[model samples]
Target: MSSDLSLQQIAESVTKSVLNATDKDLEGFQKIIDETIKVRESHRNLQRMIKSYSTTMIQRS
Candidate 1:
């Protein structure tokens, strides 16, 4: 009976550890995703500026 209790305790500890590690990993992934979105938005804005400048130059020419 004691052995069974020890086994149950070990299983619960391992489960908690695994859950915590997974949560940390998910947080890291979310941060990466957020940064990627920001970078992509900046790139798009830069492209729009370039396009506008090119159009203006063509009209001036």
Candidate 2:
């Protein structure tokens, strides 16, 4: 009786721990994705700036 109750408690605790860890992993994954998007956008902006500068130089030449 007591042993069965202990086992049930342990199982519930394990389930809760697994769920919390999964939530943390998802949050971390989302943060990484957001950072990746920011880096990609910055790269695109830099490329546009370079292209514009090149066009201006070509026009002057």
When summed lDDT is taken over every stretch of 10 residues in candidate 1, the lowest stretch is 1-10
Predicted candidate 1 versus true structure: per-residue lDDT over 1-61, tens digit per residue: 3445575786687676556677677688679779989999999999999999999999999
Q: lDDT of all predictions, in order shown? A: 0.82, 0.82
Total clashing residue pairs per candidate?
0, 0
Model 2: clashing residue pairs? none
Estimate, for each residue in 1-61, the C-alpha lDDT of model 2 and write its tens digit: 3445575786687676556677677688679779989999999999999999999999999
The per-residue C-alpha lDDT of model 1 at residue 12 equals 83
Supply candidate 1's per-residue lDDT for 22. 74
List the candidate 2 regions with Cα displacement exceeding 4 Å: 1-21
Instruction: State residue 21's C-alpha deviation in candidate 1, in Å.
Output: 6.1
